[model samples]
Target: MAAIHMRMLGYLVTLAMHGGNMLVMNSLLQGPVMEDPNIRTFSAMYKRFFTVWTMFLQLFVASLGLTTDYYTLKYRNKKEPQWLGVMRSVKNRIFAAVLWPTVFLVSSLFWSLYHYDRSLIYPLFADKILSSTANHILHTAVIPLVVWEVIFQPRSVPKKHGVNVTMLTVYMFAYLFLMYYTYIEQGIWMYPIFGLAYNKHICFPLIISAIGVMLFIYYHMQWFLTRIVWGSQVKIKK
Candidate 1:
């Protein structure tokens, strides 16, 4: 009973934090940031970035988690409804397979490149427009929040790990396609690192392949951590 209550509290807290971050991001998009000609030009493409997409995914997973918890509490004495069970399954799969890995990848890559050369990832001028609070929430805070979810919320190990890998592969390629499409249309690479490639034909594939490998490693690392924390026999509520 205490564990159940704690999980509920975790869900509520995550939902509130992500919800607040979303509000901050939205305000930045709609507020005075748009007054800058450079920012205004890229506003439409903002949602196309992986960071924005993962943030939405985090917000969604938190929202679904809270809803599932609410219904579970309300129906504690009754048999779980089919809809609730389905919702729980979807939330778990998405959180485990997609959101967790993406958050880690985005945070790791952003901080690494930002430190190496802000020009490659985030330029100095961006600081003039985007708030420090918003930057940390988007890039830094997500790491801890997702880690908290994994540590506290027990999720069933997928019977077939290939399914998760396949989903991740599709997501990676889809984003790769979007990035290339943006370059074709805008005549600029979304990230300056791509522009630095002497031969994009060779370098881009290598970079993407490296990212794919990292994401695969991240997936297995997450699975191993889940098992370590929850044990191999962690059961899911039907």
Candidate 2:
């Protein structure tokens, strides 16, 4: 109970910050959704928009953490319940063991690209579009919060956690395909890196290769997390 209490603080903070962004995004009266040309890049386009990985994964951990912790408390000290099944729904072994760690990588890659060339990832005129609170909480805050989760709540890894690496790769490829398909459907490129128009022959392979590199990075991250926390790789038999 004490251990969970300590960790819950980390999760609560993360939830508040993430949910704050959600609130801002959907504030209705003061919401980010009002049609303003200044923030059009920030708010518009579901799949054909700019990098959405941060928003997707941020919401994922917040929702998953909340739900999982809810169940953990509900079923605490009780007989075997549906918690394991709940975990399986999120494929949480890989989540705690791999995907969560990748948040750092993704964050790094995003901001790095943004910093290197703002318009390459995010445009320049829209620099001050999001309030600093919104920008910092959504973009910068994940680092400390995720690191806190990693240090405090190093959950168990399944014996077959390799599936996570594969799933993540599939997700990346799926997103890539979606981006291309969306361009065909709507005739626009989401990120500035793709420029106003792109040559698929050159960019597609590069994008595919980048996804592969990200997956490979996750494999090593799995090894590093497994070794550091559990002191060895522990895989549960499927």
Winning candidate number (lDDT) = 1
Each model's TM-score? 0.89, 0.76
Regions of candidate 1 where Cα sits further than 4 Å from its true position: 29-35, 232-238
lDDT of each residue in 21-105, candidate 1, tens digit only: 7676667676766788768756767788788889888878888888888898899999989999999888888887788888889
Best by TM-score: 1
Report model 2's TM-score to 2 decimal places. Answer: 0.76
What are the RMSDs of all candidates, in order? 2.7, 4.2
lDDT of each: 0.80, 0.60
